[model samples]
Target: MGISEMRRTGEGIDERSNFIMYHKGEVAGHRGVGFLVKLNLKSQITGFEGISDRIAAIHIHLPNHSKNWTVIQVYSPTEQATRTDIDNFYNNLTEITEKYSENNLVIMGDFNAQVGARAPGEEQIIGKYGSGKRSENGKKLVTFLLENNLTILNSVFRKKPKSKWTWLSPDGKTRNEIDYILTNKVKEFSDTGIIQNLNFNTNHRMVRSCLCESGTKKPRPKAIQMNKTQISNEIWNPITAPEDLMTVATSDIDLKEKYNKIENKLKEQTRTDITKSQQTYLSEETIKLIEDRKNLITKKDKKENQKEISNLSKQIREKIRKDRIIKRNKTLENYISKTGGTKKALKELREQGKEWITKLKDKNRPTISRNKIQNIATDYYRSIYKEQNPNQTKTQLPAKQQNIYNINKIEDIPEILESEVEKSIKSQKMEKAPGPDKITNELIRGFQVNGQNRT
Candidate 1:
């Protein structure tokens, strides 16, 4: 779908290790708000919405947890913004947060304001360890927090005054705790502070919050799973990027660079344009049982709840095992239903067909290197062509045939018209499998243009 005509504002930014940018202006500008889920935790995301350029929300539904989480990432307007704009930002945010009141709520990112300390009425909203003098915007944020049952996590944790600030002024003389992580799960919070060791290029020091139940331990940060070669070849597509990334017709970049930019943009389009929902094997009853067991485990009276918990755990385990068997049966049934795909699926399971071979062999060559694998097929084709043209030579070709084989300039090629694009899409086989970009013929054919918008 074309983003140019998308709604300007109202929900929250969608989440993925692959990101969802909420662009505000019609033009490609620098300002926007977004968030990225961890690669391992991407499946936990239930939904997300890009309401406005300033605010967005992502929901996470983790099995066994008492409640799902709705994390709202916001970039509040600067102090220079009009009073009306500022009020609207807070009002809209409150509306969205309230909409997901059932979920364990988390509001994070740059508030662009400071909450000095706990006032008489804000005892539950903030802690005694608040950073500095609260500004006007800060008061607004605190009021929003108070009304919404959000506790400023950073305020609750003990840290030196110098260590609490997240953003530093350009002159290096001013530091403020403008950024914050506010959540209702204050009891589960382990720690909160500024992280300066990270390699981010920004004026703000990262604010991190570690949260867990009473007896739960903090998990180590997950390392991105990839080998040295993959890491070395990786491109810097940072998850935090929130700007329009459309390709520009500029001479500064080479054709390869331009091509890569366009390909990357298309890939992002394909990712966001499609619907992605996580599939769960366990049934609702089993999930509820697991959640009940978790809640029991967190109770104060362990002995009283222990027997019930054990029974619940056993039932959960049994249910999970049964679900596994059912899933396997269903998978097999699906494979059997697909006439040609069954063989392909079985081949994949056995790792016997079209598997990447590290080495190639030829009778004459004996053994071939990775780079020489292409030669095996090329040689076979070469021999067949050679056999067919035993009496022929390149110099024996006609003048017209030789001229047709000559290299031509890119500029000399006819430009593809809009009509050609429409025709090409319409001509595709709808029954065929989707391409690498996941653009199936059915999906392309489903596209409709209404007024100025492409849908």
Candidate 2:
């Protein structure tokens, strides 16, 4: 079977680790809300991604307890970066990691930058294709390694001299060592600092580090099988001595008061019935006396029931009313924060005026299309021009002047011709506001005109 077949055999971990505890009772890591389960290796290995750009997933290689190798995969599907950029990106890899003391710290990837330019003592060439110089981008990568205090274990200086280059360009024109194997602990690489190149038929060269010799193996941890059904009996344990005492006292007092009121009520009802019967029997001339007593009993029972129901209804209504008042106050406070109360009336009036203007403008818009109006105006202009200039040839003026003349007629048409003529009439009436009468004898002698008043 293939590696995929091996992975499929261990697929029982699909739903086992879907939920995880991070911190104390934060109720987090649910799928889609904060994280999502991403499957790889054909229903075998599972992963998670965040809603935000980057995601980090931790897989428990061991059976129990989080003492396992964590995979921090940074997926940048659309990003193409210089060596400096990728170096800066993964520089803070160990910042938030829960470090395991005895376990291994394996950091291996396609670094995309070489260790040194021309085997250390040569002039550096930056960004020149296939130049083996320690480029400026390469320096940034070195700085990132130094800042993290992570050793470049795959370095030619540390490894054997013959095993320097690990990767080569497919075009045969360029060859440089780029991929890396790094670790914080020195024991992770078996003290030899060996870097061997594997001639695999892939873009990446596989670099593996061993912590022990072939016989001395890492100790396997015991499996911790959790019984899911065994809930902790002390789950709800807290300091409840004061609350327990208070509850006992309150319950006792409430029961005593309730029983006393019931007893008093029963006595008062018996006395009232006796008084009613005595009054009824004193006037024994009344017919249907038995029916009257029965009606009285029924009425009293109904009144008692109705009184209890009304009290309960009032209690519910009062609670709802108080809740509504609180909500209304909160809403008012939010409104005040947005717009102060001093401007509320003015704001309402302004909104009303704006709405009115919008409605009026919409009402006044022309029902006919602009082209239809243009045709009608052209016909009216032709008629007006013919009436004004009788017996004249159509090509008398320049073509531009003729067009202008036709346009001028449309403008000079009567004000009553347009639709919404009432508004136009109202506007004219407003413009021609009536002036004070000046028909006195002195004013009549001052003008001395044959036409109307010039004063």
lDDT score for residue 83 of model 1:
96
Candidate 2 local Cα displacement, residue 400, angstroms:
99
Cα-based lDDT for every prediction: 0.64, 0.38
lDDT against true structure, model 1: 0.64
Residue 318 lDDT in candidate 2: 59
lDDT by residue (141-216, candidate 2, tens digit) is 5665565555555542344333455554544345556655555554434642323322112323345455544344
Work out the TM-score per prediction. 0.45, 0.28
Give the lDDT of residue 442 in candidate 1: 48
**Residue 411 accuracy (lDDT) in model 1:** 38
1-455, model 1: which lDDT tens digit per residue? 01222233432333232443333332245345555445555456555555567776666675546788777877788899999999898989989888887778888888888889787888888987875688989889878987888899998889988688777665446768888898987886789887753322245777888766544556878953434354345443422121223213244688898767755544444444342222577888888997787677556554466467667868888998898777666666777776535654444334222222323467765432333555776887888877555566655668877676674532387899978886777777744656766655544454333322121
Which portions of model 1 show Cα errors greater than 4 Å? 1-27, 213-455
